[model samples]
Target: MLPPPIPSQPNVAIPTSWPPSAYTYPPLLGNIQTPSVHPSGSAGTSFGYSQAHQQYAVQRQFWATKAYQSSVADTITLCFKILREVPGKPKGILVRNLTEGEPNVLASITPPGLRQLGIQRMETKLTAALRGLRVDWTRIPLREIVIWVDLAHQPPDIAYFHARCMTGKEPQPAPSFKKQTKAFELAFVIDSEYWEEIEQQLADDEVRSCSFSKISNRSSNGRRSSQHTLDGSTVDLESHARRPSPDQEDDFELDRASFNRNEDHSPVCAFSADLTRALKVSVTAPRTPPPSKRRIIYQSPNQDHLRDALLEGGSSYSQLWGQGPNSTSEQIQFFAINDCSLNDLLADRRFQGFVCDPANACMGSLVIEAGNYLGIGTFKTAEMGYLTLLHLTAGHLGPRANEPVAVKRMYKRRKTPTDANPGKWVLNRLTSADEHSKILMEANVLFWATSIMNFTYSFIYHFIQSSSERPPFEISEIRFVRAGVAIVHNQSTGPTTLKCSISRTYLIEERINEAKDGFYKFINNGSAVPLTMTRKDASELSEFLAFTQHVQFYKTKGAVYLSDLQGSMQLLTDPQIMTSPLIGEGAEIFGDGNVPSAFNSFPEQHCCKHICRWFELPELAASTDSDTRSVISNS
Candidate 1:
């Protein structure tokens, strides 16, 4: 489409009679008042003594022409072509001509991609949409676009800001052969077609002094974010005072002026990185300083004095860890709702586990706690949308040398409401929070499950050293639920669930000798198990009727088979043990008649597909099995 021509000098004399009238500038663009270029020596609203009204009328005639509005409108049409491919994300569409016209406009991009999109096609940076966080190397035709946006300033040079998308800085070294692939890569470069589109815009606007022809090599490359040296990297940092290796106090105080506070200067943040190991450890007050993360801080004598004064004024700091007889498990404190910063907690070594939320539906308050998973259950809110099913850490129950201290995960949601996009409404565009990021934490401690996976492993190992410590029962078999929820009410109650349905599939069906390892592999081999657990309705269990709010276990297991319900339970309806039957025969809770009222185990098969869905695996499709629910009393 041809661009419309808008005159630079509008307030000029002309014939009184012309069909042209006042320009109707787009209100959406706020009157297009671009630093006013009014005619010489006269106010924008003025005219001559004799030809005043006539001159003004003629200027309006020129301003009201169809040519003026087309310039801005055409740029949008071209940019729109590229933005339409993103599934549900907001991308940026910006257009800038070289020397002729520096009139660059940035708008949010659209979705459904190239062919699926409903716009014209362009092959360069002129039109592009940011796809997945990490890109596939061979899929796109172009792999490198020189970026020019400044990361430090806002209205982030949108052109340069996102012109390139990738994660992590490339480690400085020759980009040589055989280096293992990192998390992401920068792809897609600005294309020549983009410049052509701008040329088209200038052609439409007659008054455009800057023409696309004059503009060549309009953009160049620059670093995105100014990065600082990591913890051990000795750059721009002060050397340690040659103090007597004995006056170790010098090692504890980090110099704040050396780096950026939230970014480079975070003393606690640098140390908390999961991948980075600290060479040394030290503690200081929160005001101590920010530098290498390897340093930590405690309430120093001076800090203690400050805390005391603050506490005297009734400050609301909930210091959970105090000097007490049973401080090991409960010492981790909970920061008040008013305090959201992890700066202090991150500095403390006790900040082992963090609880991001209390699993109620949709009230988005994120809570992080520091402690063991003793009584804590695993559940976290990853990015501000749906809740994730977190498997807590062994650190909570008990941490081991290398058994990932904690692990957290979220159930991936199949669909979400449009209203769920908070970033869009706030920033006036869609973002990652919109399409939704599918990842439960890779390894984070949120609930008791945290302890089960890590701590159980630790405890079991601890048991290995001294055979006397293993918790009594043989624990013949144990399964880590992919999406099972253990709902614990107040410390007084447990599993008081009434009605709920969770489907399952027999992922692995064959029974193996105790000698085999990796049942997941065995299951994938297509062998089948003949296990049977009865599915009962809500009313079948009598304990649920008597209890108020106990913890309910909604588990989604990888394998669905019949196994011995080894543990004996005191039943809700009778004194019989629940795994099997009479004195000799065991009666399980969900077993024949001994099943507790408050307890109902609706079993289901955990196929790869279902497991993928529960965890919201990005590569797999949603599981499709309806009417196949494993209820609590189905004999």
Candidate 2:
């Protein structure tokens, strides 16, 4: 008899201020309007500008020498100290050079417009300026350039900036700021490896600058009195500082007319086109999906009668069609009964004792000794959406005797009230029998899928370990549970009466879903699809599991692949085996969860990351729009 369900823990009301002060940041400052200053060209203004510029130069000099102190040997750190703050304007943005003697001033921009120009634009400008200082990026790899923006606010508004790699053909979008404090301090960390390309872009921009100047001078009647703002905003001296002459005014009108006529042919538009073309030609195509659609073809003769007979009150269901020996050889014979190509793969010596081999198939029968249940007739029940798990002890079973084990059964849904016996409930016999068969079928396919996964993982692990180069992270182990269907006898009813067809008990630790779909969905790159977990969030173990799946899909020639991965860090359970429908017609080949849509979506969904690339797994060609149409039509 099954034990009563364990009582659930009582819900406790959480206090609004339950989180202590240590977890929270100080109150944020309110937004303030940025003032626009029209420079009067007074001695005071000139002196203030010169003083701010000098301070910036000194700050740059300090960082030039001290930059090596904070970073590793291969990287360079540039510190940008905010000398002056003007709300909504760029001023006093400075960084030091690596060269000795005098510190080269980088930029003098105010704080207001820095956020608008964004971190990526600032990094690009810094990179161009740094290149002008003749710093060898290759020697000290500038894959990521960190910019520290120290705004001289009352509470110290500080920020760090970096850009994402411009690897794609399209223009990379500007990075958003992540607020670190109550103050408007932000952190924008991005990365890019194309240094040479950026240098060329700077050269193009320089040419555009010259062209812009020539046109501006022609418009202003060759007066050439203009001040270029540090934040890329232009300030006209004739308009702001002094009244314009009639000839200058006429020239300005003419220049405006000319600029309006050639708006589409502007230098910015031309530069954008050139940049897009260069990026498109230089960048490699994104990763393709997994190859292979071959699924496991289960040719094992139907054993539905074994489950039916048990459901009809038989003592046991044996693979050998009779009373089997109480020994390990009996279990090995049970696995041999499957008679499929997957069984052949499992029989290999590499997977010996792990899942199956000639000697052992990680399967055995345990006799439930008298009054030996661990909780003494009591078991804890954990109910999930489709199955109910009972936590109990098998008792006096072998090496694992008295250890906690979990027994799983499908939730019975067809209970009817008995009129003859008032208040008594009875399950529909036919539905109960069908559910029993399903439980056994699911267990059988699960075992087969786990064996294949284990085999593939073993191959990939050994391959990586034996290679000349090592991966960045250590390859962690991932072992799925070895389970099988078993028949429980109801001794209380009478010695030979069948109890139920259920899964053999296996222990589990704290469980977590590493990846999942309808059963187990593989996470894609975060850019295209929104998922709870992506390639970035995957741990070393998850990556290895993903790689295993990749190899299995390809090695089996795309016949079958495992997904819906969930388990402890080392041990996993309840995986979904996705088989191509081309191999079999029915969904029940593996289980009800094995759908054709999931199988078809594999190429589009799976995001190949480091481990896949490390093994140099062959890329799966993406199906074109026409191919998809044909598949839909055929289906």
Candidate 3:
């Protein structure tokens, strides 16, 4: 039988008011539905229950009354955001065990009757008396907004996380549940047109959701692909509206007519510390960020602007992302991608050969791993890990710092030692400075212009290794420029010291001229062992670590190019006249097909000591050359 209805006023007719269309609760308010009630024990009569009717007669009668409609319309609004936990907290999903006597997060705001029942809650609700107001979005202008939030505890380069050890991000293989505890806090309306911007975002979201379902239904495996596709599309759409890049529409077709190569959306994009630092720099020191949803900038020729340059130095580039002096405590800080993942940077073709001296060239191009947060595997020590070119970075691009970068793919992946460093090689033989020096001088002389330095190698390796001695493991980035530091690894847990000093910069023409001369000697003149590194390898490395801001690699006539945004992607050339270091008398190693006087005297050393220096360490150490016992033979 239908229950008796709640008592109503003498005039029980439904109300005609703005509350009906203004709020969502009580569903279709003021609808003229029959409100017959059956009397089981109420002061009013109730109708017998009809199974076919579905809804209760009493509920229908109660909602139909003008008094009931007024109550539901008083409901206020609230917002929420999904986020993940940072590192330095419990890792690998710590089981939740609520503490005893935990503070009552939600106060007792239920009705007088429900309050007596003593049911604790976590959400506080408030009632707002109604004031009839029209919400015509078209007529009303929108506003912009900037927001900031603070969470107590956090970790470096970790994302979607807060102080409570809760990571909103559900990485594959992690336990997930339907109901997630809310931990996000927000500060809104900081910018001028904040409201309008939010309204536009919401509108765009609605359109994308509607179209996403339609598009997915057409795919053969739409059901499984829906989630990623929708996410990728939503990000692209939002980026286009908010921060459009020049090459956002540039197409690079794969085998399929429309391949979903969403490389820009890697987990690295979600890194909080790195992004915050990038934004800080972008805004503080203004550099027009390359257009897109992708945050990385690759160095390319003036001909092709989308491509930014790669100046890498480190075998464990992945371990040191979004890092700074305070990176350890703050989970989400903005940072520069001076040492970006070569894999991510090189995903497109525009990445010309990672420029390094002929000496460190053996260290190879940037090693890239498109894994968690765009892992940049081991690179040569000759390359500097930190961004030497500070002016070019956009760390503080303000609120628009996270504008999705439009990365146009110009180059395909090429398999070479310079570019390939997967996640598995666990044993990296350490090379001594002397052996590396030999190679820098002999097989390659690029080392003279560029030198290598490792600050806290053991500190990093011990932290990242999964088990006993993985060749590539976690590395701790020491803030100071360490020189002649000693790393004594005793069971992977010990103190290490970094001894480094001030920094210095060199003229470009001088280095390149030496390179050209050495290049000719090694390739054209057919020297038994090429003059790679100069006498200043150590000093250059020390100075690079201690002082260089950023190493600018502007090719005189190189393979890559950069496109200008003002026009239709026109190629621009660097104005400087940088002669190859090998050509003129101004060159260090090779001047007019002549070896330096030191090489003339020290022929036995062959002026190629830098290359062999890196091999002295076990990871990069070489075995005895039984075939060529001459130590520097077989060239």
Candidate 4:
């Protein structure tokens, strides 16, 4: 039998004044005696402060202080925190109020009453409510929501419902029922529209009495506008933005020295102290080394011998190159290939790489585990179009022993023997060794291109920090996994031939409690344009990424830029370098993914946003027009 629904609390009057001025709760140290600040800024002895209580107080204070901002991203973060920290009784009321109009539906779906509903049930009810309002729950801009329920105090059915949500392949099993509490976190990408709706509802209910006109006037005087002129003058909203003149640029550089000297002591708003500290840390962080200028020396068999050995399953690359003695152990040897010879700004050692060395060319080796390995003993497989990823721990007895590594092999289908062709290796529609090499080449190019992208991003980061108009902006540092190609011997089939694979170093880290998702594609390979403004893309991180691309295009003089920007908050992979065909003898530089048309269409497709205008990057349309005129005159 289901429990009766809890009675709804009477509607409390909303606070009239904005920001609430101050919180009355004890300073977050629960049950422990500590000195607390009084209303007059005097310290007083207080007791009963615990870690959880402190966290709750601080979070509530943070929400109260910033709630008036009405930012979609901020609201989602605040609401998620409230749901996680609030007690069951209050949480039930909050959830009920959030889904007010659909109480009957919520009750029908979750009969155990709102307070007793499991995390999964609660999520379902919230989702249904949002959907009823014509909102897409998937697009809610919430990357993750972690819930911990004291199962010792809750019903068994609630725990079972929560455990059932973990039905698919999970990194870990559901918490044991023997434990007092159970916890789980879900990661996903969400849209911004839902949050906007929630924000509007929140404003209408709680902040209806606040004077928005007065707040706007105060904000206008204190805050910097994205469309402000280089001279810090206000511009008309509808005006066509113009690039800063060379003289203005010179003036900016001239102010750099003074800006840096006074930066540490600059007056900051009281509410922005946390932001200032973060900015300081990021600005002062040690820079990564640039790409190596030294030439890459190949110490293995030539391309022909290596390809033949792989296809025919004959001699190993070590034997062909006479590098090591012949061994019976089925070992895979990976040689690093560094073919990046671009003499661009990235070649300079003075410039720092973002989060990794752009010239990370190294070798690695892995031994194929014996026994029931062919029967998928411990290897987990995830198949993509061109590559098949195998997740397994390294068995090689070395520093990397027992370390997790993802092995990537080109997806191939074996062909049956025919009179003319015989048995051959094929990928997609291509069956030749040359075609195989082309695919491998494309992979190598992508790996190198990631480094180039990181380097360009680093350059832009430094530029923003050192600029006179240093906007209070932050770009999340993006690092790609260090990867290299490995040639594995066919151990299961008696090891006469070698197979090619890419080995990526993998590491597990704690998930950050932030609004950003695990992975996002900011831009696509087909176009230079960025993704549409969702709450995630509207963040400062996404804006900076788009700005970096703009700066790269401008600095390179229309030679090259990067697109297909996909990855997590601080780590990225598989980037496409968009190069202009008009440059460097008119050839495709970074592989087939490097659509030259993307570069040509950039001017038309790109709509400059806040960061671009703040950095005073050259307008692509203007530059293209000037280039066209020059070409016509020359003709």
> Of the candidates shown, which would achieve the greatest TM-score relative to the real structure?
4
* lDDT for model 4: 0.41
Residue 265 error for model 2, in Å?
72
- Residue-wise C-alpha lDDT for candidate 3, range 1-635, written one tens digit per residue: 44344344123333323132332233232333444542345544334322223334445676678564643211111122211232322211111221112222222122221112111211111001001112222322111111232311222234322223333465666533222243222211112243344444444433333222122111121122111232443122121112112122111111111112222222111122322232231112123443563477686557333233232333356446533333211011121112222223335443312232323211111111122121121221121112122122332111222221111111123344543565434323223343333222221212111111111121111111111112221111222111111111222234654532111111011111122322111111222232333435322332222111111111111111111001001110111111222233345431223333322222232222321121111111112224223221311
lDDT of 1 by residue, 159-211 (tens): 32122232344794533222122211122322444434443433322111111
RMSD of each: 33.8, 35.2, 29.2, 28.3
Q: What TM-score does model 2 achieve against the real structure?
A: 0.32
Candidate lDDT scores, in order, read 0.24, 0.39, 0.23, 0.41
Comparing 2 and 4 by TM-score, which wins?
4
Task: Return the candidate ranking by lDDT, descending.
Answer: 4, 2, 1, 3
lDDT (C-alpha) at residue 88 in model 3: 29
Which regions in candidate 3 have their CA more than 4 angstroms from the true location? 1-60, 63-448, 451-597, 600-635
| Model 3's TM-score against the true structure | 0.18
Cα lDDT tens digits, model 2, 519-617, are: 233333121122344345344556666666677665555566777665555566666677766664554576666777777667666678876776677
Answer with 1 or 2, whichever has the higher TM-score: 2
Candidate 4: worst-modelled 10 consecutive residues by lDDT: 73-82
In candidate 2, position 186 carries an lDDT of 33
